[model samples]
Structure formats: C-alpha cells, structure tokens
Target: MDNRTNLDDYLAELGISEADESVTPPPMPDASDSAPVQEAADTDARGTLERFLRGLIARIDPELSVTVREVDDALEAEISGENAARLAGRDGRTLGAIEVIAYTVLSKQEGRGDTRVRVDIGGFRKRQADTLSKLAERLAIGVAKSGEPHELQPMPAAERRVIHIALKEHPDVMSESVGEGASRRLVIKPRHG
Candidate 1:
C-alpha cells in the first residue's frame, strides 16, 4: 500500500529481507567525535549494502557470490560464480538494473544517500571498458591519418565516457558526444595544429 511496503515487497522478491527498523538513536557527540562517528556510519552503510547485494544475488542463484569494496570513494560490488555472465544479461542490461535498484535502496536509508554504488557482474564492465578503450585507440589512429571524424554507434552515457577517457590525452585526436538522449553517440576527430 505505502512506499515502504512496496519497497519491502520488491526487496523480498529479490531475496533481501526487510532490515529491522527499530534502531535506537545515538546520543549527540562533541565536535571532536564527529570524524569517528561519520567513519562508523560509512562502515555500517557499506556492510548493510554488501549484505543486501549478497542476499539479492543468492536469491537469483545460490551459487553466486558478491564482493564489495571501496574504490575511489565509491562502493564497488563484483559478482562472480557460474551464473555471473547470465546475470549480466545481454549488453549488461540486467546488471545495470541491479545497480540502479541497489543504489535506490541504499539511498533510501537515512544517512546513506550520498554513497555511490557500482555493480559489476563477472567482469562485464571491465571487459567492455577494455574493448571500448582499444576501439578508441584504433579509431583515433584512423581519424588522425585521414583527417576526418569517425562517429561511433549510439551508446549509454557510461560507455561514451569510456571512449572520452580513452582519448582524453590523445596527441592527434579528440572525442565528443553528439546527438541527444538515446541517439547520443561519440565522435572521434583529428586534432589539427
């Protein structure tokens, strides 16, 4: 009926039980204790998220496992095991959905909304980044030699970012995103002096 109930139902379907909501409030602390309190909150949030992800993945496939770690001020959850590839889905749509849901749930918590979450299944994101990086390199070379711009197929913003980062410091080429929304694409162009 209510949003909380709906969220609980959704999480239940995903195999994550509703967390106990009966937490006792902590006493006010002095300024000197603020840093430790914040650090403890961060650790608690990370542990909660890790447990949630592990439960969700286990529901999908009992054999799957998730490892969560902090990377660049964000939480990265890597799912592995026999069903990892299948869970990633075609073009990683499933993985993307999982990441979105995970973040949404995490943000709903009182103090965890600012935490950033990244979910990668079976190294899918890593492999895709490597491929995109290599493609950017090859295209930059061609564009430099031909003095023409090469446009890439439409892709999600994240993928486009990969291409941009790949060519960020290229001596003879530059990358840009053109178009809008779902039709947006990356273009590699020669950088003339």
Candidate 2:
C-alpha cells in the first residue's frame, strides 16, 4: 500500500477514523459582535497554537519547550531548550517548514481559518529579519549612489517583504520583487527625478 494508505491504517488502528474528522464546526461570529467575543476568539486561537506546538515539540524532542503568544494579528511561538537548535536546521529551513505546517493545521481548524502563525526557534527569525533590514538599507544606499538597479539574492516572500518595508520610505531608492516562486528576488533601484 501507499504511504497515505499506511498512515490511514495506522490511524485506524489507533481508533482515529475518517469519521472523526467530519464533525461540524460552529458558525463564525459576526463582525458586529462585541469586543469580548473577538477577544475570546483570540484567546482560543492562542491556546490552540500553544497546545499544537507543545505536542509537536514533544514529538521532535521532548527536551524542547514551546511557548505561544499573540503578537499583533499573528500567533508567535518560540521553541527553546537544549535541542532547540536541531529544529532550526541550516538557515532555519526546518523551522520554516514547521511554521508552514503549524499555519496549515491552525487554518484548517474551526474559528481559526484566518489565524496567522509564526514559529521561531531560538530567536532565529528576529535575527534574520534584522539582518535583512540592514542589508536592504545598505543595498538602497548603493543603488542611490550608483543610479543602477541591484538585484538581491532570491528569498522567500517574507524576507522580500522585510526588504520592501525597509526601503518603502527611502527618498532615493525603491524596492520591487521580481521573478516567481523559489526563484523570486528583490531589486533595488534609484528613484528618478
């Protein structure tokens, strides 16, 4: 049998059937609902994220600890412990993968379809953002002086956003994303008079 079939059979043996996944979810609250309702939803989303991360971290490494909190409109989760570095992998590819998975899982749950998730292991994401911002600033200065467009190394949409935001208010240069998918990158160009 295929891997998917194997997984299904495994779950069946564990008493988790496809029927268990079909429970109907409650209707979403109206936008006109009171502030307390929205606050409750936010709290529920945070609790769900925290529980999900705790289970995932236990599977990866029981020594790792996960803490989730609401940051603006997103759920920010920090994984730290003796083995937290293992989850970061090379250039944080593994951490990125986990974040994507977490987002997908949370988005599929009732009342959480719009919830955003950000997973960071050992503050890697914050450091990366800071580095990208600095790099964008330096590149913008160069483009302003040379009066030529400079293409940045291909990066994910999030990193490209960091670059774009960093230069959005610059007087002499602007940034734009080019290409598509994995090959997409940012270009810094001088503003014309």
Candidate 3:
C-alpha cells in the first residue's frame, strides 16, 4: 500500500501536495508548468527589486554588517546569512514593511506598473509566510466556530493578501480586507453572514 496521510496534514507539513502522492515538499514553488512565465517575470522584476533593496539597506542599517545581493531570477533581494534576524524584525514585520515600500516605490518609479514581485529580506518573508499561513488557518477555524468576527492587526496589503489566500479553502469562513492605505487589515468572519 502507498503511504497515505490526511490532506490537511500534508498541506501543513509541505505547504502543497500532489493529487496522488503522500510526499511532502518544502515550502517553495514546484517550478514546473509556469517556469517560463515565472522566469520571465523574475527577470523583469530583478533590476528594480535590487535597486529598491540596495537603497533600503543603505538607509536602514547601514552599519549592521549586512549587505544586499542580487540574482538574475530573483524578485526579492537576499542578504548573506551574516545578518538575518535584525533585518527580519520581529517575525518579519520590518522586512514586510520594507518589501511593501520597495514594491510601491519601484512600481511607481517605473510608471505605475503593477509589477508582480516578491521582496524577501534574508528569507524572513519566506519563513513568516509559512508560519502565518498556519496561524491564519487556525484563526479562521476559530472564528468560524465561534461565529464571531476577528479583526487582525494592521498589515500591508500584500500580507493581508497572504492571509486571505491561505484561509480561502474553508467554506465556513470568509475574509475581508478593510481600512485604507498602509494601515489596512484583514477581518475574518463566519461565512453565513
């Protein structure tokens, strides 16, 4: 018999799954069908991403023993392992803020383009996404069970999008993004209205 496990367990562990397999994958993309599109997007996204990142570092912790590095197919800038936690902020809030700012700035600088880019400062956003995904799922379940709406703290539109997408699968709950501009937040509520 093939090894089998619950789908939720699979998603929790691997962040994704195959239709017929029990194997768990790491929390990165599969890079199969959309490789070319992804590759092209990243190629187009990198130059602006790097310029934004370098400028951010120069302004923030200029003497923190850290530096920004660029790659061809990267939509986000990475720093050497030497400096992660400090730049990452508490659970990546600071990093997320930086990324949002860069995305907004670069997208505007390039003439109001909705460029699809992800900014990862030292992998902080990566880890935070995984962690927040699970947290959002659980919190959604709780909100559904209690039939009470939950208002999350303010976060960027991107992060609110992250949580909104993560909890989309559960039919018992729904999410709405409210507030305006930088102070926006996601509110979870029972689906029945």
TM-scores of the candidates in the order shown: 0.78, 0.75, 0.55
- Candidate 3 segments whose C-alpha is farther than 4 A from its true place: 1-45, 51-74, 90-113
Q: Number of clashes in every candidate structure?
A: 0, 0, 0
Candidate 1, residue 125: CA error in Å? 0.7
Which residue ranges in model 2 land beyond 4 Å of their true spot? 1-35
TM-score of 2: 0.75
Model 3 lDDT vs. the true structure? 0.61
When summed lDDT is taken over every stretch of 10 residues in candidate 1, the lowest stretch is 20-29
Model 2, range 1-193, lDDT digits (tens) per residue?
Answer: 1112122333356585542333222333355656686797787667656666765665557788888888888899999997787679999999988898677556654347677788999788889999999998888888888899999889889899988999999999998999998999999999877
- Steric clash count of candidate 2: 0
Q: Please give the range of 10 consecutive residues that has the lowest summed lDDT in model 2.
A: 1-10
Candidate 1, residue 4: lDDT:
37
lDDT of 1 by residue, 1-193 (tens): 1123233455566686764334222222233544577676666556656766765765567698888887777889999997688899988999998898888767775356678899999999999999999999999999999999999899988899999999999999999999999999999998878
Question: What is the RMSD, in Å, between candidate 1 and the native fold over all Cα?
Answer: 6.1
Candidate 3, residues 160-192: lDDT per residue as tens digits?
Answer: 878888878778888999889877889999888
**Candidate numbers, best TM-score first, in rank order:** 1, 2, 3
Which candidate would rank higher by TM-score, 1 or 3?
1
* Winning model by lDDT: 1
